[model samples]
Target: MKKFALIFVVVLSLVLVGCGANSDKASNEKKEEAKTITFQSEDGKIEVPAKPKRVVVLSSYTGDLINLGVNIVGADSWSFDNANFKDALKDAKEVSEEDVEGIIALKPDLIIGSSTMKNKDKLKKVAPVVTFTYNKLNYLDQHIAVGKAVNKEKEATEWANDFEKRAEEAGNEIKAKIGENASVSVAESYDKQMYVFGDNWGRGTEVLYQAMKLKMPDSVKNSALEAGYYAISPEELGNYTGDYLVLSRQSSGDNSFMKTTAYQDIPAVKNNRVLEVESSKFYFNDATTLEYQLKTFEDFFLGK
Candidate 1:
Protein backbone atom coordinates (compact mmCIF):
# COMPACT_ATOMS: atom_id res chain seq x y z
CA MET A 1 0.00 0.00 0.00
CA LYS A 2 2.89 2.46 0.84
CA LYS A 3 4.58 1.73 -2.52
CA PHE A 4 1.31 2.23 -4.43
CA ALA A 5 0.68 5.62 -2.68
CA LEU A 6 4.21 6.81 -3.51
CA ILE A 7 3.74 5.84 -7.18
CA PHE A 8 0.37 7.63 -7.34
CA VAL A 9 1.92 10.86 -5.89
CA VAL A 10 4.69 10.76 -8.51
CA VAL A 11 2.15 10.27 -11.30
CA LEU A 12 0.08 13.24 -10.10
CA SER A 13 3.16 15.49 -9.95
CA LEU A 14 4.14 14.52 -13.53
CA VAL A 15 0.63 15.26 -14.84
CA LEU A 16 0.65 18.72 -13.16
CA VAL A 17 4.08 19.50 -14.65
CA GLY A 18 2.90 18.42 -18.10
CA CYS A 19 -0.23 20.60 -17.82
CA GLY A 20 1.90 23.63 -16.76
CA ALA A 21 4.18 23.09 -19.74
CA ASN A 22 1.20 22.88 -22.08
CA SER A 23 -0.23 26.10 -20.67
CA ASP A 24 3.10 27.92 -21.16
CA LYS A 25 3.30 26.62 -24.69
CA ALA A 26 -0.22 27.83 -25.43
CA SER A 27 0.60 31.32 -24.08
CA ASN A 28 3.72 31.55 -26.27
CA GLU A 29 1.72 30.41 -29.27
CA LYS A 30 -0.81 33.15 -28.67
CA LYS A 31 1.94 35.74 -28.47
CA GLU A 32 3.45 34.39 -31.71
CA GLU A 33 0.07 34.52 -33.39
CA ALA A 34 0.08 38.30 -33.05
CA LYS A 35 1.19 39.56 -36.51
CA THR A 36 4.08 41.92 -37.21
CA ILE A 37 4.79 44.40 -40.00
CA THR A 38 8.09 45.93 -40.99
CA PHE A 39 8.68 49.56 -41.81
CA GLN A 40 11.74 51.04 -43.57
CA SER A 41 12.33 54.49 -42.14
CA GLU A 42 14.88 57.26 -42.55
CA ASP A 43 16.02 57.03 -38.93
CA GLY A 44 16.25 53.19 -39.03
CA LYS A 45 14.17 50.06 -39.57
CA ILE A 46 11.13 49.34 -37.42
CA GLU A 47 8.75 46.40 -37.04
CA VAL A 48 5.24 46.58 -35.58
CA PRO A 49 2.69 43.92 -34.92
CA ALA A 50 0.11 43.78 -37.72
CA LYS A 51 -1.26 46.71 -39.71
CA PRO A 52 -1.44 49.82 -37.54
CA LYS A 53 -5.11 50.34 -36.86
CA ARG A 54 -4.64 53.85 -35.45
CA VAL A 55 -2.17 56.07 -37.37
CA VAL A 56 -1.10 59.71 -37.27
CA VAL A 57 0.54 61.40 -40.27
CA LEU A 58 2.34 64.70 -39.66
CA SER A 59 3.54 65.95 -43.02
CA SER A 60 3.59 65.51 -46.80
CA TYR A 61 3.17 61.72 -46.80
CA THR A 62 -0.47 62.23 -45.84
CA GLY A 63 -1.51 62.12 -49.49
CA ASP A 64 0.57 59.02 -50.13
CA LEU A 65 -1.02 57.20 -47.21
CA ILE A 66 -4.49 58.30 -48.29
CA ASN A 67 -3.81 56.98 -51.77
CA LEU A 68 -2.74 53.62 -50.30
CA GLY A 69 -6.11 53.35 -48.51
CA VAL A 70 -4.64 53.50 -45.00
CA ASN A 71 -6.91 54.59 -42.22
CA ILE A 72 -5.54 57.63 -40.40
CA VAL A 73 -6.78 58.26 -36.88
CA GLY A 74 -4.99 61.60 -36.48
CA ALA A 75 -3.19 64.15 -38.66
CA ASP A 76 -1.76 67.67 -38.69
CA SER A 77 -4.20 70.37 -39.67
CA TRP A 78 -2.00 72.12 -42.19
CA SER A 79 -2.90 73.26 -45.68
CA PHE A 80 -1.39 70.63 -47.94
CA ASP A 81 -2.89 72.28 -51.03
CA ASN A 82 -4.72 75.29 -49.59
CA ALA A 83 -7.40 72.67 -49.03
CA ASN A 84 -8.66 71.56 -45.63
CA PHE A 85 -7.74 68.13 -44.27
CA LYS A 86 -11.37 67.12 -44.58
CA ASP A 87 -11.26 67.91 -48.29
CA ALA A 88 -7.97 66.13 -48.82
CA LEU A 89 -8.42 63.36 -46.25
CA LYS A 90 -11.99 62.47 -45.61
CA ASP A 91 -12.90 60.83 -42.27
CA ALA A 92 -9.43 61.34 -40.78
CA LYS A 93 -9.07 62.87 -37.33
CA GLU A 94 -7.40 66.28 -37.40
CA VAL A 95 -4.99 67.51 -34.74
CA SER A 96 -2.90 70.61 -34.27
CA GLU A 97 0.87 70.82 -33.82
CA GLU A 98 0.64 71.93 -30.20
CA ASP A 99 -1.98 69.34 -29.34
CA VAL A 100 0.28 66.72 -27.81
CA GLU A 101 -2.30 65.90 -25.21
CA GLY A 102 -4.92 65.48 -27.91
CA ILE A 103 -2.70 63.18 -30.00
CA ILE A 104 -1.95 61.02 -26.99
CA ALA A 105 -5.62 60.90 -26.20
CA LEU A 106 -6.24 59.16 -29.51
CA LYS A 107 -3.91 56.28 -28.51
CA PRO A 108 -2.33 55.85 -31.91
CA ASP A 109 -0.51 52.66 -32.90
CA LEU A 110 1.78 54.48 -35.34
CA ILE A 111 2.80 57.98 -36.30
CA ILE A 112 3.95 58.66 -39.87
CA GLY A 113 5.93 61.87 -40.07
CA SER A 114 8.53 63.86 -41.96
CA SER A 115 11.91 64.98 -40.63
CA THR A 116 10.25 68.23 -39.64
CA MET A 117 8.78 66.91 -36.42
CA LYS A 118 10.59 68.92 -33.74
CA ASN A 119 9.36 66.90 -30.77
CA LYS A 120 10.72 63.48 -31.60
CA ASP A 121 10.81 62.27 -28.00
CA LYS A 122 7.28 63.40 -27.28
CA LEU A 123 6.01 61.83 -30.48
CA LYS A 124 7.76 58.53 -29.79
CA LYS A 125 6.43 58.51 -26.28
CA VAL A 126 2.94 58.63 -27.70
CA ALA A 127 3.50 55.77 -30.15
CA PRO A 128 5.93 54.25 -32.67
CA VAL A 129 7.03 56.98 -35.05
CA VAL A 130 8.27 56.48 -38.60
CA THR A 131 9.75 59.49 -40.36
CA PHE A 132 10.74 60.12 -43.99
CA THR A 133 12.78 62.61 -45.97
CA TYR A 134 11.70 63.94 -49.33
CA ASN A 135 13.87 63.17 -52.33
CA LYS A 136 13.54 65.81 -54.99
CA LEU A 137 12.35 64.47 -58.37
CA ASN A 138 13.39 60.90 -57.51
CA TYR A 139 9.79 59.89 -57.19
CA LEU A 140 10.66 56.21 -57.58
CA ASP A 141 12.99 56.19 -54.61
CA GLN A 142 10.55 58.23 -52.54
CA HIS A 143 7.73 55.83 -53.33
CA ILE A 144 9.84 52.77 -52.55
CA ALA A 145 10.97 54.18 -49.21
CA VAL A 146 7.50 55.27 -48.12
CA GLY A 147 5.94 52.08 -49.48
CA LYS A 148 8.30 49.83 -47.55
CA ALA A 149 7.59 51.81 -44.39
CA VAL A 150 3.84 51.25 -44.75
CA ASN A 151 4.04 47.60 -45.93
CA LYS A 152 2.86 48.61 -49.37
CA GLU A 153 6.08 48.16 -51.31
CA LYS A 154 4.40 46.49 -54.26
CA GLU A 155 1.70 49.12 -54.45
CA ALA A 156 4.24 51.90 -54.19
CA THR A 157 6.26 50.39 -57.02
CA GLU A 158 3.16 50.12 -59.17
CA TRP A 159 2.26 53.73 -58.46
CA ALA A 160 5.78 54.87 -59.25
CA ASN A 161 5.86 52.86 -62.47
CA ASP A 162 2.54 54.27 -63.52
CA PHE A 163 3.71 57.78 -62.62
CA GLU A 164 6.85 57.43 -64.73
CA LYS A 165 4.89 56.04 -67.65
CA ARG A 166 2.39 58.85 -67.40
CA ALA A 167 5.17 61.42 -67.10
CA GLU A 168 6.82 60.00 -70.21
CA GLU A 169 3.50 59.92 -72.03
CA ALA A 170 2.80 63.48 -70.94
CA GLY A 171 6.23 64.46 -72.14
CA ASN A 172 5.56 62.83 -75.47
CA GLU A 173 2.20 64.50 -75.71
CA ILE A 174 3.74 67.90 -74.85
CA LYS A 175 6.51 67.33 -77.37
CA ALA A 176 4.02 66.45 -80.10
CA LYS A 177 1.91 69.48 -79.23
CA ILE A 178 4.69 72.04 -78.77
CA GLY A 179 7.35 70.53 -81.03
CA GLU A 180 10.61 68.94 -79.82
CA ASN A 181 12.58 72.16 -80.17
CA ALA A 182 10.25 74.19 -77.97
CA SER A 183 12.10 76.18 -75.31
CA VAL A 184 10.58 76.46 -71.84
CA SER A 185 11.52 78.44 -68.72
CA VAL A 186 10.12 78.02 -65.21
CA ALA A 187 10.69 80.68 -62.60
CA GLU A 188 9.37 82.11 -59.33
CA SER A 189 9.80 85.50 -57.68
CA TYR A 190 10.41 86.11 -53.99
CA ASP A 191 11.42 89.38 -52.32
CA LYS A 192 11.93 91.15 -55.67
CA GLN A 193 14.36 88.53 -57.01
CA MET A 194 13.66 86.02 -59.80
CA TYR A 195 14.52 82.37 -59.09
CA VAL A 196 14.70 80.28 -62.23
CA PHE A 197 14.60 76.51 -61.95
CA GLY A 198 17.66 74.55 -63.06
CA ASP A 199 17.88 71.12 -64.62
CA ASN A 200 18.74 69.59 -61.23
CA TRP A 201 16.59 71.97 -59.22
CA GLY A 202 13.59 69.62 -58.98
CA ARG A 203 12.16 66.60 -60.75
CA GLY A 204 9.63 68.69 -62.61
CA THR A 205 12.34 70.62 -64.44
CA GLU A 206 14.17 67.38 -65.22
CA VAL A 207 10.99 65.92 -66.69
CA LEU A 208 10.31 69.13 -68.61
CA TYR A 209 13.78 69.19 -70.14
CA GLN A 210 15.03 65.61 -70.19
CA ALA A 211 11.81 63.67 -70.62
CA MET A 212 9.67 66.18 -72.48
CA LYS A 213 12.64 67.01 -74.72
CA LEU A 214 12.04 70.72 -74.19
CA LYS A 215 15.13 72.86 -74.71
CA MET A 216 16.29 75.52 -72.29
CA PRO A 217 16.34 78.92 -73.94
CA ASP A 218 19.90 80.06 -74.77
CA SER A 219 19.62 82.81 -72.16
CA VAL A 220 18.77 80.32 -69.40
CA LYS A 221 21.00 77.45 -70.59
CA ASN A 222 24.18 78.76 -68.98
CA SER A 223 22.41 80.14 -65.91
CA ALA A 224 20.47 76.91 -65.33
CA LEU A 225 23.78 75.07 -65.14
CA GLU A 226 25.22 77.60 -62.73
CA ALA A 227 25.58 76.69 -59.07
CA GLY A 228 23.17 78.14 -56.49
CA TYR A 229 20.01 80.16 -57.06
CA TYR A 230 21.11 83.13 -59.16
CA ALA A 231 19.24 86.40 -59.20
CA ILE A 232 18.09 87.79 -62.55
CA SER A 233 16.84 91.29 -63.15
CA PRO A 234 13.52 91.83 -64.85
CA GLU A 235 15.57 93.54 -67.62
CA GLU A 236 17.52 90.28 -67.96
CA LEU A 237 14.23 88.41 -68.33
CA GLY A 238 15.18 88.05 -71.98
CA ASN A 239 17.95 85.72 -70.83
CA TYR A 240 15.29 83.35 -69.49
CA THR A 241 12.93 84.16 -72.33
CA GLY A 242 11.69 80.98 -73.96
CA ASP A 243 8.85 79.88 -76.24
CA TYR A 244 6.97 79.18 -73.00
CA LEU A 245 7.33 80.59 -69.50
CA VAL A 246 5.99 79.03 -66.31
CA LEU A 247 5.69 81.39 -63.36
CA SER A 248 4.76 80.44 -59.82
CA ARG A 249 2.64 82.79 -57.79
CA GLN A 250 4.10 84.01 -54.53
CA SER A 251 2.70 82.50 -51.35
CA SER A 252 1.51 85.87 -50.00
CA GLY A 253 -0.56 86.62 -53.08
CA ASP A 254 2.02 89.07 -54.30
CA ASN A 255 2.05 89.48 -58.10
CA SER A 256 4.14 92.66 -58.22
CA PHE A 257 6.72 91.03 -60.48
CA MET A 258 4.14 90.23 -63.13
CA LYS A 259 3.24 93.93 -63.32
CA THR A 260 6.80 94.91 -64.17
CA THR A 261 7.27 96.20 -67.71
CA ALA A 262 10.26 93.93 -68.22
CA TYR A 263 8.13 90.87 -67.40
CA GLN A 264 5.35 92.04 -69.67
CA ASP A 265 7.83 92.64 -72.50
CA ILE A 266 9.23 89.12 -72.47
CA PRO A 267 8.43 87.07 -75.60
CA ALA A 268 6.58 84.44 -73.55
CA VAL A 269 4.41 86.97 -71.75
CA LYS A 270 3.73 89.04 -74.86
CA ASN A 271 2.57 85.97 -76.71
CA ASN A 272 0.47 84.88 -73.69
CA ARG A 273 2.55 81.65 -73.38
CA VAL A 274 3.21 82.28 -69.68
CA LEU A 275 1.50 79.82 -67.36
CA GLU A 276 0.96 80.63 -63.71
CA VAL A 277 1.48 77.74 -61.28
CA GLU A 278 1.07 77.42 -57.53
CA SER A 279 4.36 77.74 -55.65
CA SER A 280 3.50 74.84 -53.34
CA LYS A 281 2.78 72.49 -56.22
CA PHE A 282 5.93 73.53 -58.08
CA TYR A 283 8.17 72.77 -55.08
CA PHE A 284 7.06 69.35 -53.82
CA ASN A 285 8.42 66.36 -55.83
CA ASP A 286 6.79 63.33 -54.23
CA ALA A 287 5.38 60.63 -56.55
CA THR A 288 1.79 61.38 -55.59
CA THR A 289 2.07 65.17 -55.79
CA LEU A 290 4.20 65.01 -58.95
CA GLU A 291 1.19 63.96 -60.98
CA TYR A 292 -0.45 67.32 -60.31
CA GLN A 293 2.69 69.19 -61.36
CA LEU A 294 2.98 67.11 -64.53
CA LYS A 295 -0.69 67.60 -65.29
CA THR A 296 -0.35 71.36 -64.80
CA PHE A 297 2.47 71.49 -67.31
CA GLU A 298 0.63 69.28 -69.78
CA ASP A 299 -2.53 71.33 -69.50
CA PHE A 300 -0.67 74.61 -69.89
CA PHE A 301 1.69 73.60 -72.69
CA LEU A 302 -0.45 71.03 -74.53
CA GLY A 303 -3.83 72.63 -73.77
CA LYS A 304 -5.03 69.12 -72.91
Candidate 2:
Protein backbone atom coordinates (compact mmCIF):
# COMPACT_ATOMS: atom_id res chain seq x y z
CA MET A 1 0.00 0.00 0.00
CA LYS A 2 2.87 2.39 0.82
CA LYS A 3 4.62 1.66 -2.55
CA PHE A 4 1.36 2.19 -4.45
CA ALA A 5 0.76 5.52 -2.67
CA LEU A 6 4.33 6.75 -3.53
CA ILE A 7 3.79 5.79 -7.20
CA PHE A 8 0.51 7.76 -7.33
CA VAL A 9 2.19 10.87 -5.83
CA VAL A 10 5.05 10.71 -8.32
CA VAL A 11 2.63 10.46 -11.29
CA LEU A 12 0.59 13.41 -9.96
CA SER A 13 3.78 15.50 -9.61
CA LEU A 14 4.83 14.69 -13.18
CA VAL A 15 1.39 15.67 -14.53
CA LEU A 16 1.49 19.09 -12.78
CA VAL A 17 4.99 19.75 -14.15
CA GLY A 18 3.76 18.90 -17.64
CA CYS A 19 0.81 21.27 -17.30
CA GLY A 20 3.09 24.07 -16.14
CA ALA A 21 5.41 23.51 -19.06
CA ASN A 22 2.52 23.59 -21.52
CA SER A 23 1.22 26.86 -20.02
CA ASP A 24 4.65 28.46 -20.32
CA LYS A 25 4.94 27.33 -23.94
CA ALA A 26 1.53 28.80 -24.77
CA SER A 27 2.48 32.11 -23.17
CA ASN A 28 5.73 32.24 -25.15
CA GLU A 29 3.88 31.45 -28.37
CA LYS A 30 1.43 34.26 -27.72
CA LYS A 31 4.26 36.70 -27.07
CA GLU A 32 5.93 35.70 -30.32
CA GLU A 33 2.67 36.06 -32.21
CA ALA A 34 2.39 39.58 -30.84
CA LYS A 35 5.91 40.54 -31.99
CA THR A 36 6.65 39.16 -35.44
CA ILE A 37 5.11 39.38 -38.91
CA THR A 38 6.09 38.49 -42.46
CA PHE A 39 6.09 41.55 -44.69
CA GLN A 40 7.27 42.61 -48.16
CA SER A 41 10.75 43.99 -48.67
CA GLU A 42 12.69 45.66 -51.50
CA ASP A 43 14.58 42.48 -52.28
CA GLY A 44 11.58 40.41 -53.30
CA LYS A 45 9.16 38.90 -50.76
CA ILE A 46 11.13 38.77 -47.54
CA GLU A 47 9.71 38.18 -44.08
CA VAL A 48 9.99 41.01 -41.58
CA PRO A 49 8.30 42.18 -38.43
CA ALA A 50 5.14 44.15 -39.03
CA LYS A 51 6.53 46.80 -36.78
CA PRO A 52 10.20 46.47 -36.12
CA LYS A 53 11.37 47.28 -32.60
CA ARG A 54 15.07 46.83 -33.10
CA VAL A 55 16.18 48.53 -36.33
CA VAL A 56 19.69 48.52 -37.73
CA VAL A 57 20.09 51.12 -40.49
CA LEU A 58 23.23 50.54 -42.53
CA SER A 59 22.80 53.64 -44.69
CA SER A 60 22.64 57.42 -44.70
CA TYR A 61 18.86 57.50 -44.15
CA THR A 62 19.06 57.22 -40.38
CA GLY A 63 17.66 60.76 -40.15
CA ASP A 64 14.62 59.64 -42.12
CA LEU A 65 13.90 56.99 -39.47
CA ILE A 66 14.38 59.54 -36.72
CA ASN A 67 11.92 61.83 -38.47
CA LEU A 68 9.42 58.97 -38.40
CA GLY A 69 9.96 58.61 -34.63
CA VAL A 70 11.40 55.09 -34.80
CA ASN A 71 13.83 53.56 -32.36
CA ILE A 72 17.20 52.64 -33.85
CA VAL A 73 19.64 50.14 -32.36
CA GLY A 74 22.46 50.15 -34.89
CA ALA A 75 23.66 52.32 -37.80
CA ASP A 76 26.59 53.13 -39.99
CA SER A 77 29.17 55.74 -39.02
CA TRP A 78 27.55 58.46 -41.15
CA SER A 79 24.48 58.52 -38.90
CA PHE A 80 26.68 58.92 -35.83
CA ASP A 81 28.71 61.61 -37.59
CA ASN A 82 25.78 63.93 -38.31
CA ALA A 83 25.75 66.67 -35.69
CA ASN A 84 21.95 66.61 -35.50
CA PHE A 85 21.87 62.83 -35.12
CA LYS A 86 24.83 62.36 -32.79
CA ASP A 87 22.82 62.72 -29.59
CA ALA A 88 20.08 60.40 -30.78
CA LEU A 89 22.55 57.82 -32.12
CA LYS A 90 24.98 58.14 -29.23
CA ASP A 91 23.88 54.83 -27.71
CA ALA A 92 23.45 53.12 -31.06
CA LYS A 93 26.11 50.65 -32.13
CA GLU A 94 27.99 51.09 -35.41
CA VAL A 95 27.77 48.50 -38.20
CA SER A 96 29.67 48.67 -41.44
CA GLU A 97 28.35 48.01 -44.92
CA GLU A 98 30.35 44.76 -44.96
CA ASP A 99 30.11 43.86 -41.31
CA VAL A 100 27.80 40.86 -41.28
CA GLU A 101 29.15 39.61 -37.96
CA GLY A 102 28.70 43.01 -36.34
CA ILE A 103 25.19 43.36 -37.73
CA ILE A 104 24.17 39.85 -36.64
CA ALA A 105 25.53 40.57 -33.19
CA LEU A 106 23.05 43.42 -32.83
CA LYS A 107 20.22 40.95 -33.47
CA PRO A 108 18.18 43.53 -35.30
CA ASP A 109 14.67 42.85 -36.52
CA LEU A 110 15.02 45.16 -39.56
CA ILE A 111 17.90 46.51 -41.60
CA ILE A 112 17.66 49.24 -44.27
CA GLY A 113 20.01 50.89 -46.71
CA SER A 114 20.96 51.41 -50.33
CA SER A 115 20.98 48.42 -52.66
CA THR A 116 24.66 48.99 -53.32
CA MET A 117 25.78 47.47 -50.04
CA LYS A 118 28.30 44.76 -50.96
CA ASN A 119 27.40 42.44 -48.08
CA LYS A 120 23.65 42.74 -48.54
CA ASP A 121 23.28 39.04 -49.32
CA LYS A 122 25.33 38.03 -46.30
CA LEU A 123 23.44 40.43 -44.07
CA LYS A 124 20.18 38.72 -45.04
CA LYS A 125 21.23 35.67 -42.99
CA VAL A 126 20.96 37.92 -39.94
CA ALA A 127 17.81 40.00 -40.65
CA PRO A 128 15.50 41.32 -43.34
CA VAL A 129 17.41 44.02 -45.21
CA VAL A 130 15.40 46.50 -47.26
CA THR A 131 17.32 48.23 -49.99
CA PHE A 132 16.60 51.51 -51.78
CA THR A 133 18.13 52.84 -54.94
CA TYR A 134 20.40 55.60 -53.74
CA ASN A 135 19.63 58.97 -55.35
CA LYS A 136 17.08 57.39 -57.64
CA LEU A 137 14.05 58.98 -56.04
CA ASN A 138 13.44 62.47 -54.79
CA TYR A 139 13.91 63.12 -51.09
CA LEU A 140 10.20 63.07 -50.28
CA ASP A 141 9.64 59.88 -52.22
CA GLN A 142 12.61 58.29 -50.51
CA HIS A 143 11.12 59.00 -47.12
CA ILE A 144 7.74 57.67 -48.18
CA ALA A 145 9.28 54.44 -49.47
CA VAL A 146 11.15 53.97 -46.22
CA GLY A 147 7.98 54.60 -44.26
CA LYS A 148 6.09 52.02 -46.27
CA ALA A 149 8.87 49.49 -45.76
CA VAL A 150 8.62 50.00 -42.00
CA ASN A 151 4.78 49.88 -41.97
CA LYS A 152 4.60 53.60 -41.14
CA GLU A 153 3.41 54.92 -44.49
CA LYS A 154 0.74 57.09 -42.90
CA GLU A 155 3.23 58.78 -40.59
CA ALA A 156 5.62 59.33 -43.48
CA THR A 157 2.87 60.83 -45.64
CA GLU A 158 1.92 63.30 -42.91
CA TRP A 159 5.52 64.34 -42.47
CA ALA A 160 6.02 64.69 -46.20
CA ASN A 161 2.92 66.88 -46.50
CA ASP A 162 4.04 69.11 -43.68
CA PHE A 163 7.48 69.40 -45.19
CA GLU A 164 6.07 70.37 -48.58
CA LYS A 165 3.84 73.04 -47.05
CA ARG A 166 6.72 74.45 -45.04
CA ALA A 167 8.99 74.35 -48.04
CA GLU A 168 6.47 76.23 -50.19
CA GLU A 169 5.99 78.90 -47.56
CA ALA A 170 9.71 79.33 -47.10
CA GLY A 171 10.21 79.36 -50.83
CA ASN A 172 7.63 82.09 -51.23
CA GLU A 173 9.28 84.13 -48.54
CA ILE A 174 12.70 83.68 -50.14
CA LYS A 175 11.35 84.50 -53.59
CA ALA A 176 9.61 87.57 -52.23
CA LYS A 177 12.81 88.74 -50.58
CA ILE A 178 15.29 87.82 -53.29
CA GLY A 179 13.05 88.66 -56.27
CA GLU A 180 11.15 86.28 -58.56
CA ASN A 181 13.68 86.21 -61.34
CA ALA A 182 16.88 85.57 -59.42
CA SER A 183 18.67 82.43 -60.56
CA VAL A 184 20.31 80.17 -57.94
CA SER A 185 23.10 77.67 -58.51
CA VAL A 186 24.51 74.87 -56.35
CA ALA A 187 28.19 74.06 -56.68
CA GLU A 188 30.47 71.86 -54.62
CA SER A 189 34.23 71.56 -54.42
CA TYR A 190 35.95 68.37 -53.28
CA ASP A 191 39.66 67.93 -53.58
CA LYS A 192 39.87 70.96 -55.94
CA GLN A 193 37.28 69.45 -58.30
CA MET A 194 34.11 71.45 -58.98
CA TYR A 195 30.66 70.26 -59.99
CA VAL A 196 27.33 71.95 -60.69
CA PHE A 197 24.30 70.19 -59.24
CA GLY A 198 20.72 69.57 -60.28
CA ASP A 199 17.67 70.03 -58.07
CA ASN A 200 17.83 66.55 -56.55
CA TRP A 201 21.42 66.42 -55.35
CA GLY A 202 22.03 66.77 -51.60
CA ARG A 203 24.13 69.91 -51.94
CA GLY A 204 21.39 72.53 -51.31
CA THR A 205 20.05 72.05 -54.82
CA GLU A 206 16.75 70.68 -53.57
CA VAL A 207 16.00 73.72 -51.47
CA LEU A 208 17.45 76.18 -53.92
CA TYR A 209 15.72 74.87 -57.04
CA GLN A 210 12.95 72.40 -56.20
CA ALA A 211 11.56 73.62 -52.84
CA MET A 212 12.11 77.34 -53.17
CA LYS A 213 11.24 77.34 -56.88
CA LEU A 214 14.39 79.25 -57.57
CA LYS A 215 15.67 79.31 -61.10
CA MET A 216 18.81 77.49 -62.14
CA PRO A 217 21.23 79.17 -64.49
CA ASP A 218 20.61 78.37 -68.15
CA SER A 219 24.13 77.06 -68.47
CA VAL A 220 23.70 74.90 -65.39
CA LYS A 221 20.35 73.58 -66.57
CA ASN A 222 21.73 72.78 -69.96
CA SER A 223 24.86 71.16 -68.63
CA ALA A 224 23.90 69.63 -65.24
CA LEU A 225 20.16 68.96 -65.36
CA GLU A 226 20.31 66.06 -67.81
CA ALA A 227 23.02 64.22 -65.91
CA GLY A 228 21.83 65.55 -62.52
CA TYR A 229 25.24 67.14 -62.14
CA TYR A 230 28.07 68.26 -64.37
CA ALA A 231 31.75 68.57 -63.69
CA ILE A 232 33.28 71.87 -64.78
CA SER A 233 36.75 73.34 -64.77
CA PRO A 234 37.12 76.35 -62.50
CA GLU A 235 38.04 78.52 -65.49
CA GLU A 236 34.63 77.74 -67.05
CA LEU A 237 32.75 78.08 -63.69
CA GLY A 238 31.29 81.42 -64.80
CA ASN A 239 28.85 79.69 -67.14
CA TYR A 240 27.18 77.62 -64.46
CA THR A 241 27.42 80.21 -61.69
CA GLY A 242 24.11 82.03 -61.27
CA ASP A 243 22.83 85.04 -59.35
CA TYR A 244 22.95 83.18 -56.02
CA LEU A 245 25.66 80.60 -55.44
CA VAL A 246 25.70 77.79 -52.85
CA LEU A 247 29.24 76.56 -52.35
CA SER A 248 29.79 73.28 -50.54
CA ARG A 249 33.27 72.50 -49.28
CA GLN A 250 34.10 68.92 -48.33
CA SER A 251 37.42 69.86 -46.80
CA SER A 252 39.55 72.99 -46.47
CA GLY A 253 41.39 71.78 -49.63
CA ASP A 254 42.74 74.42 -52.04
CA ASN A 255 40.21 77.25 -51.46
CA SER A 256 42.29 79.03 -54.04
CA PHE A 257 39.29 78.52 -56.31
CA MET A 258 37.48 81.22 -54.33
CA LYS A 259 40.32 83.64 -55.07
CA THR A 260 40.65 82.60 -58.69
CA THR A 261 40.07 85.32 -61.27
CA ALA A 262 37.43 83.04 -62.85
CA TYR A 263 35.55 82.55 -59.56
CA GLN A 264 35.71 86.13 -58.27
CA ASP A 265 34.48 87.49 -61.59
CA ILE A 266 31.08 85.85 -61.18
CA PRO A 267 28.33 88.35 -60.40
CA ALA A 268 27.06 86.34 -57.42
CA VAL A 269 30.49 86.24 -55.84
CA LYS A 270 31.01 89.95 -56.43
CA ASN A 271 27.60 90.75 -54.90
CA ASN A 272 28.11 88.52 -51.84
CA ARG A 273 25.30 86.09 -52.79
CA VAL A 274 27.42 83.07 -51.96
CA LEU A 275 26.32 80.83 -49.11
CA GLU A 276 29.10 78.62 -47.80
CA VAL A 277 27.85 75.42 -46.14
CA GLU A 278 29.75 72.40 -44.89
CA SER A 279 29.68 69.37 -47.17
CA SER A 280 28.94 66.97 -44.32
CA LYS A 281 25.89 69.02 -43.34
CA PHE A 282 24.61 69.50 -46.87
CA TYR A 283 25.39 66.08 -48.37
CA PHE A 284 22.28 64.42 -46.99
CA ASN A 285 18.72 64.46 -48.41
CA ASP A 286 16.99 63.42 -45.18
CA ALA A 287 14.56 65.43 -43.05
CA THR A 288 17.09 66.78 -40.54
CA THR A 289 19.36 68.08 -43.28
CA LEU A 290 16.41 69.52 -45.21
CA GLU A 291 15.30 71.45 -42.15
CA TYR A 292 18.83 72.77 -41.73
CA GLN A 293 18.88 73.76 -45.40
CA LEU A 294 15.55 75.62 -45.07
CA LYS A 295 16.71 77.47 -41.96
CA THR A 296 19.95 78.51 -43.62
CA PHE A 297 18.06 79.89 -46.62
CA GLU A 298 15.55 81.71 -44.38
CA ASP A 299 18.32 83.38 -42.42
CA PHE A 300 20.24 84.37 -45.52
CA PHE A 301 17.36 85.37 -47.79
CA LEU A 302 15.25 86.99 -45.07
CA GLY A 303 18.39 88.78 -43.92
CA LYS A 304 17.65 87.59 -40.37
- TM-scores for the candidates: 0.75, 0.84
Per-residue lDDT of candidate 1, residues 128-191 (tens digit): 8888764432546665666676677889889877777777888887778778888888777666
247: Cα error in model 1, Å: 1.3
- Residue 169 displacement in candidate 1 (angstroms): 1.8
Go through the candidates in order and give the C-alpha RMSD of each one to the true structure.
7.5, 8.3
Model 2: lowest-lDDT 10 consecutive positions? 34-43
Query: Model 2: runs farther than 4 Å from truth?
Result: 1-34, 37-39
In candidate 2, position 149 carries an lDDT of 76
Compared with the true structure, what per-residue lDDT tens digits does model 2 show for residues 1-304?
9999999999999999999999999999887666555455556776667778889997878888888877898988877767778777877898887888888888888999888888877877887888988787788888888888777889988888888888889889888888898989898887768899988878777777787788888989988887888998877878888889888885556778888888889999899999998787788888878888888888888876
Which stretches of model 1 miss by more than 4 angstroms?
1-34, 76-78, 84-86, 93-99, 190-193, 199-203, 210-213, 217-238, 250-252
lDDT measured at residue 90 in model 1 versus the true structure, 0 to 100:
63
